[model samples]
Target: MINLFHFVLILTLIVVVISVAKIKDLLSAVILFAVYNLIMSLLWQQMRAPDVAITEAALGAGVTTVLLVAAISKTGRLEK
Candidate 1:
């Protein structure tokens, strides 16, 4: 059961990564990347690494998402 959950999470992460890479819209990619980070944090939590999970959630998912959105708003939302 745990293995299945882990597999699904990893598979979802891979799919999100591929989508982010393929996406031409910068905003969409950023959003997907944020979600990927969230999943990673969740995985860390499940693995009993609370410290890593907290860091990943705060930095990777939270701050990074905010910064990316701010940058995108200042520049452009879509890629040329």
Candidate 2:
């Protein structure tokens, strides 16, 4: 049986993924992508992979999000 916390995390991941794809603003999508990564890190921790979780949190949510945001700042935030 799936625990409530895990189920909620999975559901949040799904929602964030969809939101990232559907969002039109580049900044907003990047933020949602960061959220997705954070949730994925939590799920990885729940699955007993601390290393993977740490990597995801640091690289995916931290570095990648900052890079994308910086790129968006240079390129502009709108999709088109």
Candidate 3:
């Protein structure tokens, strides 16, 4: 059962990662990247690496997402 959850999480991450890459909307892509980072943090935790998970969550999901949003707001939503 636990392993099933892990599989599903990984599958969802893969789909989200693909969506992030294929998206033309900058804002949407940033959001998806943030979600991907969050999922990665969870995966790291599950793998027994709490330190890495915390770092991933803080930098990838938190600070990076904030920075991306600020940059996007300064520019535009759609990609050229």
Candidate 4:
């Protein structure tokens, strides 16, 4: 069961990565990248690395998303 969960997590990460790469909109791509981080964090927790998982969830999923959005906002192209 655990192995299956990890497999799914990795698969999700791959799919998100592909989507992020192919997406035309920078903002949407950034959000998809954040989702990728969240999936990896779940995988970390499954591996019993709670500390690392928490960090990834907070920094990768949360902080990175904020930073990306802020950067995009500064560009003014994000409005479209």
Best by TM-score: 2
* Cα misplacement distance, residue 30 of candidate 4 (Å): 1.0
lDDT of 4 at 10: 88
Rank all candidate structures by their lDDT, best first, as comma-separated numbers: 3, 1, 2, 4
Q: Write the per-residue lDDT of candidate 4 for residues 18-49, one digit (tens) a residue.
A: 99888888989888999999998998898889
Model 2, 1-80: lDDT tens digits are 68999999999999999999998988889989999999999999999999999999999999999999889888877988
- For model 3, the local distance difference test gives 0.96
lDDT of 1 by residue, 9-36 (tens): 9999999999999999999999999999
The C-alpha lDDT values of all candidates are 0.95, 0.93, 0.96, 0.88
What is residue 20's positional error in candidate 3, in angstroms? 0.4
TM-scores for candidates 1 onward, in order: 0.90, 0.96, 0.94, 0.85
Of 3 and 4, which scores higher on lDDT? 3
| Model 1: worst 10 consecutive residues (lDDT sum) | 1-10
Off by over 4 Å in 3: none
Better of 1 and 2 by TM-score: 2
* Model 3 lDDT tens row, 1-80: 46898999999999999999999999999999999999999999999999999999999999999999999999999999
Candidate 1 ranges with C-alpha deviation above 4 Å:
none
